[model samples]
Target: MGPAPTVHAESVDFVMLYIVAISVVLLIGITVTMIYFVFKYNRKKGHEPVDIHGNVLLEVVWIVIPTLLVLSMFYFGYTSFRELRDKPDNPFIVKVTARMWQFTFEYANGKKTDTLYVPLNAPVDLEMKSVDVNHCLYIPAFRIKEDIIYGQTNHLYFNAKQTGDYDIACAEYCGLNHSAMYTKVKVLLDNDFTKWYGGNWQPVKNGSASN
Candidate 1:
């Protein structure tokens, strides 16, 4: 088994922290407002609930605040996505094929295998396609995931900074054995990867074997 997923970049970590901060701020604001309104307008405080139909200022405040919040979120999310999707100048390319219950990775030298082998600190571009049904290539550690349609190819790029093993799961339900369809990703040092790629490496018989 591989180690647990880890966020490998400062930028990704910052984006996650920003999202959490926004959520906390929104939650606290809503909670405080709810409590204040409830206690201030309670019946036991000699206060009768006045049905002041609606205030134009209050309506505008609510609408404008939410609109601004949503737009801000959209802008940040779009920029982050674009940054992640942008291709590097010379990224390592790998072809990933998904079938009924297994994943096969093919490197640039035409070596096919079950496990994904990548060099640490090197950006990898994965071209994914499904042979039988729809599947999703998900690598939580890298915060990258994309769907692999039967007739279409999907792509994603990421650089792995840590040299270790990670899990590759099929996010989409393809068949009865979809739950069992999974693989491993091995991130190696640059020297070790060069040695492996330079030497003749045979493909494993099935996706269950280790790299």
Candidate 2:
């Protein structure tokens, strides 16, 4: 887990851990039970075998327990997925367009930039699309990825509590230069974001920051 963001880190990671833990427990339990049954029910040299068809309680317990476990896992998985789609209050919407090896982020004021810049502690809603082939918007640090499909608009939701520059890359194989499609998302303090959001600000050069 590298530089985990708030919302996705909590919800997504919890669901993953929950499912994994349950799987590990089930694996051990089932293996042990199988071994024990194999030893106990082994055939004796010359004894007649008893015909034990089935036990209703044992069968019901097995079916009910697995069904309940599966349902619970599905419940948590659905809730975690819903958390990503839940729009926050007082959101800052950015329109993102992806093409063959490039990403463009447009703010509400028509200010466009290659790098995504947002205020710390503020919610950001991304409206994404692709101009050419399909692309994927991926932020590894935050563990967020969304598909950018041509002729169809996609969306990604973000809320960063900390301030820093996070790496952004195209995860989908779009074209020959797909490996070179990369950018950064800068989360600035509230005061700086306000000043830059309202002013006629210019984008800084690569390897440089306005802060």
Best by TM-score: 1
TM-score of each: 0.83, 0.78
Per-model C-alpha lDDT, please?
0.79, 0.84
**What does candidate 1 score on TM?**
0.83
Q: What's the count of clashing pairs in each model shown?
A: 0, 0
Model 1 bad stretches (over 4 Å): 1-10, 199-211
lDDT of 2 by residue, 88-189 (tens): 554678899998989999997888999999887666888999889999999887778999999999988878877889989999999899999999999988
Worst 10 residues of 2 by lDDT: 200-209
**lDDT (10s digit) by residue, model 1, range 29-86:** 9999999988888778987667888899999998998798778777776777776766
Candidate 2 Cα outliers beyond 4 Å, as residue runs: 34-53, 195-211
Error of 2 at 175 (Å): 3.1
Clashing pairs in 1: none
Distance from true location, Cα of 119 in model 2, Å = 1.0
How high is the lDDT of residue 137 in model 2?
A: 96
Clashing pairs in 2: none
Error of 2 at 130 (Å): 0.6
